[model samples]
Target chain A: MFAGAAAALLVALVLALARAVLGPTVFDRVQAANTVGTLAMLLLAVIGFLTGRPDFLDLALVYGLLNVLGTFAVLKFFRYGDLGDPGEDEEHHT
Target chain B: MNTVVDILSWGFLLAGGAFCAIGALGLVRMPDFYTRMHAAGVTDTLGAGLMLFGMMLQAGLSLVTVKLIMIGLLIFFTSPSATHALARAARARGLQPLLATGKGPSKRS
Candidate 1:
């Protein structure tokens, strides 16, 4: 069952990769990349079970947190041209 | 008793995998980015939740189950925030969503 789930996740990862490659805009690419990160995290967990190493769940948890952070950081950079920029609301402080 | 748990775990895992695949298909087939975001949301939330739930059943009251729950909670809280940020950024940058009126975003591929 773990093997089956892993295979299906691999298929999903490939499809998401195709979107990332074929994306017409940067936003599309970012979105696809986010999806890919998510699929990869799930795959990691499933493969851990398939290989009898439950320790991989810790890795999966870390990956999930990173995925969310990375997505937000990239989007902020794309929007404001800088990650540290506080946007218009805090421009006065700078 | 053990057999029933195993059966239920397998079923959940299978259903989760199927949902993940279908969502990825939608990601590929959707006409635009916003629609694709909708599809990806399915994979992020439903796919991850169900699969983790299945794994929890298999773990059967262990620290592994605790870690799984932590992961689920992280995804549950952050996925929507990321999606919302992405959509807001895309819109602010003038990437209009495709509307039903047949006039899609003016930006071309």
Candidate 2:
């Protein structure tokens, strides 16, 4: 059963990859990348269960954290053109 | 009782996987970026949650279950925030959503 779930997740991952490749805009690609990260985390968990290595759950947890962080980072970068920009709140800093 | 648990776990995993695939298909098929984000949200929330729930059932009161819950919580909280940020960024950049205004897809500006 776990194997079946893992296979399905693999299929989903491929479809998401296609979107990332064919995405017309940068935001589309970013969204696709975020979805890919999520699917990969789920795949890690399912595969870990199938292979009898419960330790993989820990890895999944870490992947999930990194996935969201990566999404936010990318969005921030696109919005501000730099990761460290303080947005419109800070003025007269010339 | 054990058989019942097994069956439930299998069902959950199966449903979760199917939902994930369907959501991905929507991501590919949806026309607008905002609509695509709507589709992606399905996989992020429902697909991930159901799969983790199934895994927890299989783990049966172990550390594995706790870890699964943590991952679920992480996705649950962060997915919306990320999606919100994405939408805001797109809007700030003047990417208008495809709206069904009038006789065809029209921009809301």
Q: Write the per-residue lDDT of candidate 2 for residues A1-94, one digit (tens) a residue.
A: 9999998899999999999999799999999999999999999999899999988888888888888888888888999999998777667677
Off by over 4 Å in 2: A88-94, B103-109
Q: Which 10 consecutive positions of candidate 2 chain A have the poorest summed lDDT?
A: A85-94
Each prediction's TM-score versus the true structure: 0.92, 0.92
lDDT of 1 by residue, A7-44 (tens): 88988988999999999999989988998888888888
Q: Local error of candidate 1 at A78, Å?
A: 0.7
Candidate 1: where are CA atoms >4 Å away?
A: A88-94, B102-109
The sequence of per-residue lDDT tens digits that candidate 1 reaches over residues B2-81 is 99999999999988898898889888989899999999998998898899999889999999889889988988888888
True contacts kept of 2: 0.86
**Top-scoring candidate (DockQ):** 2
